[model samples]
Target: MHKPVLTIFYQFNPWYSTIGGIQTLINTFIKYAPNEFEVRLVGTGSDRTQKVGKWQEAELAGREISFFPLFTLENDNFRSLIPTTLKYAAALVGHSFASDFMHFHRLEPSLAALNWQGEKTLFIHNDIQTQIKAAGDKNAILWRRFPAAYFALESLLVRQFSQVFSCNTDSAQLYRQRYPSMGDRVKYIKNSFDNEIFYPLSRTEREAQRHELAKRLGLSEETRFILFAGRLHPQKDPILLVRAIAALNEPHTHLLIAGDGELAADIRTEIAQLGLSNRVTMLGALPIEDLAQLHRISNVFVLSSAYEGLPLVVLEALASGTPVVTTRCGETPKLLATDNGVVCEVRSPECLADSLQQIILHPENYPSTSCVRAAQPYAARTVMRDVYSGMFTRWEKRTLSIAS
Candidate 1:
């Protein structure tokens, strides 16, 4: 039997191993996609010297995946993205004809494909309207200023997809409410973590690793590490994390940030102004292995996001047996219901400080086993198998109907 070709689309350089949550999810799909299907990825690559449209094939985890770049640009500025959007739309139109099924990560890149009548699936990574609102004036995106109009446009784009997958339960519920006619087409699919890479270390292993990390970072062996691993964007509120750490004020408690984005300079400034330069370490965009190691060594993980769609880092932290103290965003409350972590109010440094302090001071309340158990449901293999099975079943049914 011939295998179906699944073409996945997202607006970023596919060559980059990790970008953010959406990219991580896309990589997971590529890695764990059903063996019976052939996978192709389409995205924008950044390189001024390279041609706009090019195709390349690469093997990932023993699977041969094809990649096609929609366009190449000098930088990811607003001006360059205008042409990139047009190129992406045109590329999608051409690729849609060849694909047995299409999957899109974000709505913006698919807006121009609205008229394309094809079997397309959409993954909602965040509730855009709510995210924009939460970001308020801090977000520089043009759509943030005209939220209602943007949402209307977004709704129209959503109608193009046959099915929508939301990583956050709350976002899925909101989508269902917004598009009641779609019914069961909108699904709440939780993001997952790699159990093999992110599992908790034994007490001896963890202590030794912490000692090594402390020695490397020029901290005392007794230092308690607070981790925040995500893009340093306005939505993530990295500056607020700095403020929270400043408020935390314990000499032995240090913050380890393991990602970078546009707000990196601002976060550094905040740390300097608050006199936390020595206490906060910025480890920019680490590979998965290093990130998981950070999680293992850290005493607690923290997220101060204004909004999210079930952050993968949170799952990774939980899987690594690190207690979390995060803002009330996405499905964190549900994730923390098992007493694995604490969820605090959004955009409140004082609240974040208090929560982090609580977890640090009373570590016994959140057991490592409890944290690991809470992450069991989001194991990569189980979640991906179920997701792909459901999708392929639906596609097969549609194919049979068409033949008849």
Candidate 2:
């Protein structure tokens, strides 16, 4: 039997080179995809040295996948997105002709493929309107000033796709209610974590990893770490996390941030102002292996985001047997159980601090086994199998319709 060719597109570099939920999701899907399907990736190449429109080959888990990189200015600024959006859309239009199916990770790329005649699938990473409202002025000028325009655009573009996947259940339901006609096409798909890399370590093994991490960071092994791994942006509310850490007022408790973004300087300033400079450490962006180690050793993983989809880091933390204390956003309220973690109010440092303190003070309440068990349903292989099966089902239906 001939394999179907699937082209996946996003407006960022390949997952291996970047760190984010969308990148990780695309990479995991490709990694665990059925052996019978051929996959190709299209993304932006910000490296000025690499020429755009050139095809490159990358190996993931012994499988060679084709990658086409487009030229675009990569930055957090709103103005920068215009060129990136145009470039990704143009590339999708060109690649759609040869692809058996086109899969888009986020709205921009999916909207760009509106003109494509082939089977198209979109993965909505977050509730866009909610994200905009939560972000307030921190969002782009256009989105912040006129959110209705963006909402209308999203409503228009979403209807054009054959299949739509939302990582958050709440967001999925919201979409279903908003677009009753396409409710069946909009499915809720959980973001997954690699069990092999993220599973919990034995007590002794975890201690060893903790010691190694402490030594590398020049901290004492006795220091209790609270890990925060995500972009340091307004939407993620890293500053709120810093304020929460200050409110925590636990001398032994230290904060370890593993990602970098435009708000790095602002976070540093907050740390200094709060006299948490000594207690807070920024490790910048880390490799997945390093992040997994951090997860295994940390007392608790925390996120103070204004909004989210189903954040992969939270799932990975649970898989590593590390409980999480995150704000109520995305799928967290439904995903987190009393035995696994706590959910705090969004943008409230006091609430965040209280929740973190509860988890830190009574770790036994949130058993490691319970945390790991909660993550089993979202195992990368299992989720990816379901995603691929769904896609093939849709493809089969389209084939039969064409034949008839």
Once fitted onto the true fold, the runs of candidate 1 whose alpha carbons sit more than 4 angstroms away are: 46-51, 73-98, 115-117
Model 2 vs truth, CA RMSD? 2.5
Tens digits of per-residue lDDT, candidate 1, 103-200, equal 88767768656666557888887877577777444444556767888788777787777789888887888888999988788988878887878999
Model 2, span 240-260: residue lDDT tens: 888999889666788999987
Per-model C-alpha lDDT, please? 0.79, 0.80
Q: Give the total clashing residue pairs for model 2.
A: 0
Worst 10 residues of 1 by lDDT: 73-82
Off by over 4 Å in 2: 46-50, 72-83, 90-98, 140-142, 396-404
Error of 1 at 155 (Å): 3.1
TM-score of candidate 1 relative to the true fold: 0.92
Each prediction's TM-score versus the true structure: 0.92, 0.92
State in Å the error of residue 29, model 1: 0.6
